[model samples]
Target: MGLAHVHWLLAGIDEIAAFRLVFRDDRTTDVRGTGRLVWHGRTLVWTPGGPYAHLRYTVAINRQRPPGTHFDSYATPDWIATRALHLFPEINVRFRTGVAAARARLRFRLPRGWHSATALAALPDGTYLVEEPGKRFDRPRGWLLLGRIARYRHTIAGLEVTVAVAPGSPLDVRGLFRLYGKTIPLLVGILGAPPPRLLIVSAPDPMWHGGLSGEDSFFVHGRIPIRSPDKTCSYLHELFHVWQPFHPSADGRWVSEGLAEYYSLALPYRAGRLSPQTFVRGLALFERYGRWGSDLTRTRVPAALNNSAPLVMHWLDHEIRRVTDGHRCLDDAVRSLAHEGGTLTTASFLRAINQAAGRDFTPLFRRHVYRGEPPPERAREDDAGVGH
Candidate 1:
């Protein structure tokens, strides 16, 4: 096995309070140029004596754990997750270097019979490059899986998509691939293209309950039945994130998340995976849940508010269609945002809607989304089509 060398370049560090190195393992040896190391629990309080420091450490891959719902940086025997590789404190420092640009790369010492998957692009020499422009240290950008994994490959939208599952996992890999095969086309149609490569990892842990999405990859809790409606929707929701626009302001989170929820059902229905009746039933569930108490504009919208967000989106779609005389819809607005990528805010969302409909929707947004007013009642004619 090759030794893994993790490197970091530190800039503008002049004091002890400016930085600290945290590691789960305190016995980290071969440390160079990090002055006055003090061990406080699992944290290394490094008092750097220089303005710039080059830190490198050799990490050992030890015991492996079964895939679980939560994420951590520690290595497991059969599988190695990204948290295990990039979890060191030096890479995690956010206070001083939060806004600075940073780049990272990992050289894994893969044992025989082990393979790896990550969002980072792999080099010819087997090194993985992780580059972030506006360094958001707190965000978990690095996700990896190394082990005796079962990889299923498919070509969709001119992209090579690979689904990697841990060996002995209970997840139904075939079912997952089938769902992706059907759903990905619809997603690509909406977004205008596919990522060059998509990697999905399924880790089964009875303890983990939800899924998470990263840069070009995502994780699904394997405990959920593969064909279950909830699991299917959850999987689609995470997949939608890969194509969704990034919104720095928290206010526009409703737009991003609500659209994901809206399409999680709509795409399946459009793809014939869901019957019209089932799709309407799903929307009805959202409407019922949306009536529960919560405000949409709050920085942290409650889960109940999130449950109702799709209803508002549906209403917005209907309004857009009505104003445009069927020439435009919500999809156009979303596509516009996807085409013009940046920090998405409520203003940008409104602009997209106005551009698509050729009319301003500020009043409608102010009433329903911004003010947290109750969603409009379902139209009687719409219900008849849905068989309600």
Candidate 2:
């Protein structure tokens, strides 16, 4: 039998504390110029001993999983899978000369029978390139998967897509590709920027029961279907998270999640793959869970808050459409929010809404999200003033 291969993106960069790297040789293998590596406690410090200095390091791709428990990253003898950010250690160093702005390349030397894929740009000669203009040291971040795996690669609607699964997964990879190919393109107009590539990895029972999203990548349990009979889709929800450009603060967590969950059903509905009655039923399912949710502004469990969040988006989208005479909709506000950039806050979210609607939605938010009062019901499609 062969190993599994998967691609990943860094999901939680803000909370990564121990950016650990695995070493195999003289630590100076990837280092250059005049700098001495210093170790203080568990932290590694570096300083330029001379002009024109650069440092580099390598990480071991192997990870050990707990025995029969749910985890995001884990490994068996046949393969290794986890967040690249957790695998590659973050470096802290400075340079006085030479452009600190340089691109990073990842070249792999896998076992004789193994294959691998990554979320980074595929360069000529089979290496991956990592270049982020905003950061000094572009650490290898995102999901990293390697094992006796099978990879299905495609280019649909100009987006590079890779679906990796264990050799015998029951997942319908072809159906999933058809679904994503049909719906992901629909998000570009409203979401502003779609990831140039998307990495989807599916494994078996030992993984968490749900899906988790990373940068341009997401992990899902193999048992999950393309679409449930209830009309909700875990794959779509996580894919939305990867496609999302804005990062909302704790107070506005629902804005990001609500949109992701809402669009999971909405995109297929808009694509005519899901019936209108089924779409409405999906919203009702979210509403049913939402009734048990706590306040939106508090730091409560996100799953609990998300039950009602999509219904709120449904109503808000309708409200924006009604007032704008079909000229603007919730997408207008979402675009506005995306333009603001940086960490998204509740105030910024409200400002985006007002900017899009040309009116205040503060009272609405105060009534619903903060006070825990239910948002008003969405009007009928035709009366909503926006074309479906």
Candidate 3:
């Protein structure tokens, strides 16, 4: 069967009022595209060649519905997709795909004081490779083709990448590697060893946003939010969701959001970039913002999309750690759920905790989580968000 596809055409920045997208395919004898355009951000479009000349775009695609199958969850982002795109400020787009691969060709109609470069590097496996091409800032102010090549592998997702610098302005191969080195491991740990495919594009100005759009794997818009290290962490969190292996089936905000939150802390902690105490303090801080203290066990996990619920669960995690001597906690519960094949319920969660603690968690869970009451006043002082 042929893969489903979507096309995206971005013309401007800030508010994308007339953002037009077409979902199409040529698998059948007749080639056609179908999709929708929603009023995005908060901007309007007039003349396409106005200040909107400089733009970035992305297309994301994946398998169709088959609940709990790996296909649906594959909707996450890939790192390489937007890595080079974001580094350069250029645009002009066209697309093509073949039996084994897909490609996006973007051009720089006008040089924005930079050089465009391209490179092709072989992968360790030799069969798979990567081609990274984009504009590199030049001292003399001109265009230099910058790109990299790697052996083509099973998929074009989270593969380790190396890029060639075109007589740089500031960024060099080593510097890029530094960023990649820090980025890939976290990507692998959270998403998997192989990163998902993502599309990165550079904008004339900084915007700092990333997400999945149709036909686009993962779109990272604007200049890299250098100051916001959290953005990259957040990217990994969302992009990895494509590998979730299930869909329409509730993954619980507590599971999804908590995992994202936990990983945001866990990765940095493991890297020695964050102190354990500091991490705990962060959790404590999050506890302060919680608007929930529901009896999770009795509430059936709510199945709601409220973001606050996970913060409440985070507090519960803190309580579980406190009561279970830290040896038995949400980490254990998560692992247990993952072991049980990625489907978790409040009931299953309670059972896991009780099993780990070697005791009944009913009374404890009831008093702390199921009831709307606070966890405990003693545990609430410093974490002002939680009024236990």
Candidate 4:
């Protein structure tokens, strides 16, 4: 194991003024340098006066609401589900001339009979490996489920995918598994891929009735329908969060979101779970809803625009195919954004679309994205066929 040297560490948990870190220890007794510290009003600054420092702190668990719903983070006498990112703090480290890459791993010491799982790769020795490919410093990310629970795992596409559901949560884990078996393989290729490992945590009431995506994992309310009435699948929607090539600005966020939603519909259709006619109907609904939403450029728009955004993406794909004579589509455009190598912006999105289509797409984007104009209604036959 490699130690991460740090000059300082800082962290502030949310709603912490009420539940504070009342116990902590700074183990820097043998370090060199001033070993000095400074404190300001309600704020303090400190350094171990050495290259490395270790600090341990404890916070009271402000456990959440009664079961049957969902909570972001919660605790019970029997189990706990919470984000691991909050436990790791911000640290600044220094070397003589440069920075030392920090490698982090997580090992849990639990109460007797308790077991823990994380959205991290489990090593043979039982420790979880923490890694972030583009960063010089790697910290653990994802949710942690600790306690006595039902643990089920599967190897999908050779990735260890674990599903941990609190006992008696009433989640349809079997249905979830069946869905994964049917859709995961095809979606894996469509999605670029899943992370090295995947963790899914679920519980009944006392948790949010929704889904949340973490580093390589995510949480879903046990009873939330996997496939909603409108034909959108929350399962597939959140799965897209695992692999985002570039961070998108607010203006470009629609692209990222639209793609996720697009796949939610397309993945099912492509997987044969949804028929062509039904898929077409779903797209029409989105187009109608999007017609009332704001321009795609706005950071804040009518909530209805969520439907609009995906419609925009579907049409964008349609346009890409037409312009390139079926040689390219939105997938190529999307992949180009990653290849372009920067934060996704409107300009960058346009460049990608143009590059994929081998033509200028300024007019198309100008009318729909910038001006928020709805696409011209096409004859049903025109929109009938979906590309494979």
Candidate 5:
């Protein structure tokens, strides 16, 4: 169980000289290759001695280190990082294989009492198929949990969702399920559909401050307080990613992250997850933070923390509502973007906004988003009836 072999098929290639096998700890194990193997830093560069269509290699697994460290490749007595160990090929390298898209399958040989939780669909033959469209064969994006884990399953909003928690985790699984039961339906009402399958993994790691979202899975730090405002916002933020896959651009980070932050609170408020006082407090907090800066177009982490981006989004939402006589809102613009598949850039977002509003929003975009002007102050009269 501590050793594994991998086989790869290369087609329409003149040379296999560019393939590199990445390993976390090369010193702990020896890799035997079918061809000449050279060590290039932490990777193994393999060059076939002759014209070959298939390559095979074996790795000796190291079980001493903790699982989920070192790029999430680990093998411990209780758990194993399945994807990292099975798919060791680095995608960033140039492979002259000329194969635009390649198919791959992984079969694991694990010890008894170990179970797996992954986004990959399992075939009838017990092999997991890796068939994510547009994903390179070398680098696959998904989660694979293998250990003596605790699993909770629930059908929410017509989607099969699974929650996997590591042993001895402090997370409140029941509370999370209840919260999701409330939140997922609201999200589906807004986005129109749920991901075919959703997987949530709660791992214990003091270093992981928040959560990370993948294609269909979410990873949250175990130390976060369960059902707290921060946890609720973080979970909804990642869930928003599942609904609308926003890619960060030079000037589009504000749209992606800001929208996520905005809806993380707004949707919950509309769904009754947050009280009026709490929701207004959240907006006030963002307003306070946003006063620190005005530039929303900068691609910096701190820029995302500024409240200006979300406030401007709030203004845009109000403007769209006002212009369309409450027939349209920001949700319409976001849904339009999701329908138009591709990387979401500032121009495309502006186009969506303009189409939704039925008028050009150039002046507003220039004054608020690109130029990062300070958000307009809320009048005292308006504040008097806050959250009503």
Candidate 6:
């Protein structure tokens, strides 16, 4: 084999706080993979050579790395390979001939905090191949994320993918998400397109932010401090915005933010990760925090929709659902706008809303979104569940 330099690859596994690489060559020459290392999960144990590998693993009870700090956590081989198999049952590997190749078979298991899988190899082209799976991808039946990066030395990938954990946190989905919150939305909004890449968080240091400049990849500064426990949904919310059409007039801000918020809870809710009660609690918090105080009353409102639109949009959703007897939701209005192929304005939005409501909601639109008037607070006590 050509003299091997350091290498990397993207693979998949259950979940983990960090990953450790162990490689053995044909000569059984063993080299424990180590570096500015950082950052896997699972319910079912993986079987060897049966499409997956299961290795003994453990969670980091308190492994939260500060915004700029660095730490290391290693995974057993069984854990790494098993997860990889599920992510790519039909694996298509492109390793350099004789330069370096990770062992094809391995085992992995779930221990505590999380379990993960990864592959490390150096290519002849001066690029490293790092593979991992169980990532987020919008592909049909390809939701399972997996890939390898062609990393170059002294570049973004050349820097170590540090391992980290947020201080005073558990492995709860929401908590783990919040650990990398604020930056994820901005990153997703900017980079979440085609050619998705793995995002490695080494330690919880705020200053470690770096990634590809293209409209497809993002690298979390693993060491950044967790700003709030509730910002966990920001990443998913921002990612969904990628599908929305850009509108200069309406800017799709209402639909984009509303849909983002809608899916933020919907996905987890559907997956049983969140309870309806808890979801409503989050909506309550959004209203109380009032991130955006858009005047719903003005027919022509001027404001970039972000965090604030969710609450008001939720209120609109409730009204629509109730008035339409659950026949239509905000989605219908947006779909109508999309099919019409026109920029959305106050008048156009109202037209869509009226079409979905099956009547002229001009008065309601005037009072609600444009006039910013209080919804029929007295009409139905159950309406109290809604907000604006």
Best by TM-score: 2
TM-score ranking, high to low:
2, 4, 5, 1, 3, 6
> Alpha-carbon error at 129 in model 1, in Å?
4.3
Task: Give the local distance difference test score of model 5.
Answer: 0.66
- By TM-score, the better pick of 1 and 6 is 1
Q: Model 1, 219: alpha-carbon shift in Å?
A: 1.1
The window of 10 residues in a row where model 3 has the poorest summed lDDT is 135-144
Each candidate: RMSD: 6.0, 6.7, 15.0, 7.4, 4.9, 16.8
Q: Is candidate 2 or candidate 6 better by TM-score?
A: 2
Better of 4 and 5 by lDDT: 4
Write down the worst ten-residue block by lDDT for model 2.
1-10
Could you tell me the TM-score of candidate 2? 0.81
Off by over 4 Å in 6: 1-228, 248-255, 291-304, 338-344, 373-388
**Stretches of candidate 1 exceeding 4 Å from the true structure:** 1-54, 57-76, 84-105, 129-140, 225-232, 291-293, 299-302, 377-384
Q: Which structure among the candidates has the greatest lDDT? A: 2
Tell me the tens digit of each residue's lDDT in model 4 across 221-268: 877777776677777777776656567787877777777777788777
lDDT of 6 at 307: 36
* Evaluation by lDDT, superior candidate among 3 and 5: 5
Superposition TM-score, candidate 1 onto the true structure: 0.75
Q: Please write out the lDDT profile of model 3 over residues 210-289, one tens digit for every residue.
A: 33321123322323342233322433344445333322234243445545544554455555555545555555544454
Listed in order, each prediction's TM-score against the native is: 0.75, 0.81, 0.43, 0.80, 0.78, 0.41
Q: Which tens-of-lDDT digit does each residue in 1-388 have in candidate 5? A: 5455656655544433456667665532445545577887777777655545566666654433344443333445666443443445554344455545546676666679878777666689987777666556534446566788887889888878887877656777787777778888877755667777777776664324566677677766666764444313667777777667556667787788778777777776777767666766766667666644355767465544436677677778878887898899888888887777578778998999999999999898888876777556562113224634
> What's the C-alpha lDDT at position 220 in model 5?
66
lDDT for model 1 = 0.66
Q: Scored by CA lDDT, what does every candidate get?
A: 0.66, 0.68, 0.37, 0.67, 0.66, 0.38
